[model samples]
Target: MNKPIYILGIESSCDDTAAAVIFNSKILSNVVASQKIHEEYGGVVPELASRAHQQNIVPVVASALKKACVSKEQLSAVAYTRGPGLMGALLVGSSFAKSLAMGLDLPLIEVNHMQAHILAHFIEDDSQTKPDFPFLALTISGGHTQIVKVTDYFNMEIIGQTIDDAVGEAFDKSAKILGFPYPGGPLIDKYAQLGNPNAFSFTKPKVGDLDFSFSGLKTAILYFVQNNTKTNPNFIKENIADICASIQFTIVDYLMDKLKNAVKETGIKEVAIGGGVSANSGIRKALKKAETDFGWKTHIPNFDYCTDNAAMIAIVGELKYKQNDFSDINVASKARMTF
Candidate 1:
């Protein structure tokens, strides 16, 4: 058997300060310190989010190590999210990883936040099935909504992506219009279950066959609510469930339509979804139905992997570690990156 490799992963790409310890492709422990303060502002305040990461990074990492029953000495490399996130937040993780790797005299691996979401499936867990290579990965979250062609662990190409607001933003923004709080995407999903999906209709955007756009749908919802509430006054309260259901269905259907286009374009039957929004019950049900309805194989990660967490980063780190792909101490954090 090959010798075991331990990698320490840190993620502070947004409001969550997370750390994880991985043994090869399996995760030993994952710790995340979420910034609840952002909920008060109705959205993440980048400056505040970074400050919170600075405070949580140390303890979070310590907790992950303790939970894994592993020491810093056992770690073979330090992995951290390097880009395509809030610059200040990304720096907190990248800087700490660099310093720790330097002290331990270990390899430093910088991972892309988006790719981490897709690579998260490779983590050896009994509850989840890993996707095959050359599969289609639909990454949907607050920051991105993309369909990527994954040919290998490290080789991925974004075949389609949102031109404007991401799907998560569409959910959250729609929730806000309905008087839901920050991080309201789940709330929308919760209420969507009780109402009729076709209660209201919002026209899907006329984007390219593969690309996506949600801004128009968001505006349509806003106007619909405004027009209805003008006379009814209690329109939202009276039809909260139906409104949520309709919105959720619209978004989820739009996503499926795009996925269908991707599958057709690539001729790939295996599909996987990652990122925060994959936790949506509607999307999950849709993916499951597609297995039987469309004859496509589907993969969904556990709820932990769906959100912004360190396990994904650790998995990417492990993949890179095997290839001896190390980053320099002078590597800088980026606010935007592409596959």
Candidate 2:
């Protein structure tokens, strides 16, 4: 621990195969190999995703170390995502990381995928902007929708979460209803920009407190599309942009409303957002508006770190490494893990 520590982080929790080398607290290189094979199927096929990770893991890790100008022998420990993702996908990274750690006679660190998303903000960079203790983190991703209270690097409390489907599902599923390709959240954001956000209306869910429910919104959109298309088959074609804008507006508003409630309840003005949905332009704009209108400080990660990536995992690794927190080799991957 006297010298700088180099921790290699591997994340294969989903469709993305990522690896990163963190020296001390700085991320030197982060490489991600995204699986486009799932696009044709309209969503991820766990089997295909796991196989793609098997194919990409080795080269991705090698590329990250090479880009960082670091060798495997110099690493202090190996860290990997352990849960809250597909079991097969998590196994690919966890198995590889465990094997490498054993081969190198180094320690192993296990990280929760969701926790790593929130910890991503701690990755040291030129931004020099970090959320202080007791900040609120809105972790919006494909599989999760949570509002966590962060008091320390590893200490977190999920004050709010989705009661049903996540917000990302709302965006992607809504896009599917509109005939967009898989992973259509970004495309929705793109089209929403060209249209009026208030052009159409969708019923927002009435989930009380900090918990959320996007299933209602998704159902509403589906029924609306079906009902309208019955009258005019070209309904979606003629109002694609406007429909996207309105859908995006509802989702963003739902998220912000719950966040405001959390702020009022916890009295925490420092807010940070992470996960894939954090990359949405509409959500980013809403957070910026909150900063000005609600007098809150917001922390948003760079686009590169917004999705499933090892850079975030590496930062968690660094934090645990400093505290001498190492996982035993027998640690297993979990598909659904809490905290």
Candidate 3:
């Protein structure tokens, strides 16, 4: 067997400050420090996220190393999220990884935050099996909603994407209109269980082909709530569950419709989902149903891997290390990047 490779991954791409240590394709430890401070603001403040990352990065990395029972000296390379996130947040991770790599005389590997969400499936774990190459990937999260054709590790094509607000934004924004707190996606999911998905109807946008647009749905929800609460006053309280269920169903239906189309267009039966939104119960059930309903195989990562985490970054790092794909010390964090 070849010598085991150890990669230290750092991810501060958004509000979560995370670190992980992977050895020989297996994760030893994964640590994420979530910023609860953003709750009061109803959304992430870039400046605050950066400051929190600065405070948490060191301890988070140290905690990961300790949990992994691996020391920094044994690491083979340092991997960090390079972009498609807030500039300040991305810089905190990239800069930390670069400096650590320099001090350790190790190579630096840059990972795309979006790609990390997809590559997360490759992380060695006993419970889950990785999808084969050339599979279809649906990446849905707060920032992105995309369908990708994965031909290989690091070889991916965006087959479809959202033109406006992503599905997560739809969920959160809809919840806000319902008077829910920030990070209300999970709350919507929780309330949706007892409600009727068909209780209300929202118009799905007529975006062409596989492209998606949730801005219209968001506006519709806003107007519906405005119109209903005008006379009833307690409309939201009376029908919160039904409204949430309806909204969640609408979004999931839109996503599933496009995913079915992507499968038909590509003739790829292997379907997989990633990113934070994949954790939704409704979406998970839809993907599971596709297996029997449409004769397609599906892959869903564990809940931990679904969100923005360093283990995903480490998996990509390991793949790049095998190909000798290393980034120079001068590499900088990008707020907007592709693939």
Candidate 4:
């Protein structure tokens, strides 16, 4: 802990293969190799994702080290994502990290991908005030959705989660129905700017407290389009922008509603969000608006930090290293990890 702590972090949990170098909490280099193969299929295919990671990891890590102007011998520890992602993808990063750490005689830190997403807020801008203990976090991604309570650096409790489809999944599916290309959530946000959010009303699903159900909302959109298009064949084509806006509004409202309720129940003022959907413009706007409306402090990672990246992994690794928390080579990859 005396010398400047430098860590090498690897992240290949899903489609993106990433590596980063961090000196203490400051990120030196962050490199991500995104897979373009998934674009043809509308979503990630596990086998293909693994193959892509295999091809990307080594070069990604080398580039990160070069960019950071650091050599392998200077690293104090090696870190990699160990779970809550595609099993094959996780294995690629975990195995590589283990081998590198062993060869370098360095400690190994296994990080939870979701936990890294939350900690990403700390990496890019060290000036941002750190969230207080007992802060509430909302993590929304394509595969997962949950409300978490962070009691400490490594202690987290899941208090609310999706009973069915996640909010990001709903957004992508709705975009598909609208004939947008794969990874269409961002496109929806773009087109929505040209339309009115109140142009149409979509009913929010009635799910019990703390649990979210986006399946019903997806169904409603399907039926609404089916019935309306039957009477007016050009309905979707003519009102695409408005429909996108309306759908985006409903989804954002649902997320904010649950977050508000979580704050009310937990009685915690510090709030933050992480994961891919956290990059949505609507979500960012709503969170900032809520700060004034609800009189609560809010924290959000930058756009790059919000999505899958390795800077977050480096930050989490730095924390684990300080606590002497190390992972064994026998640690295995997991597809679904719980807090």
TM-score of each: 0.99, 0.98, 0.98, 0.97
How would you encode candidate 1's per-residue C-alpha lDDT over 31-92 as one tens digit per residue? 99999999989999999999999999999999999999999999999999998999999988
Q: What is the lDDT of residue 56 in candidate 4?
A: 96
Error of 4 at 57 (Å): 0.7
Better of 2 and 4 by lDDT: 2
Model 2 scores a TM of 0.98
Candidate 1, 93: how far from true, in Å?
Answer: 0.9
- Model 4 bad stretches (over 4 Å): 124-129
Ranking of models by lDDT: 1, 2, 3, 4
Supply candidate 4's per-residue lDDT for 78.
99
User: What local lDDT does model 1 show for residue 238?
Assistant: 94
lDDT of 2 at 97: 97
Give all candidates' CA lDDT scores.
Answer: 0.94, 0.94, 0.93, 0.91
Model 3 ranges off by over 4 Å = none
Model 2, 1-339: lDDT tens per residue? 587699999999999999999986789999999999999999999999999999999999999999999999999999999989999999999999999999999999999999999999988876636899989999999999999999998889999999989888889999999999999999999999999999998877887889999887888999999999999999999999999999999999989999999999999999999999999999999998999999999998988889999999999999999999999999889999988
lDDT of 3 by residue, 178-231 (tens): 989999999999999889999999999998678999999999999999999998
Report clashes for each candidate as comma-separated counts.
0, 0, 0, 0
Q: Which candidate gets the maximum lDDT versus the true structure?
A: 1
Error of 2 at 225 (Å): 0.6
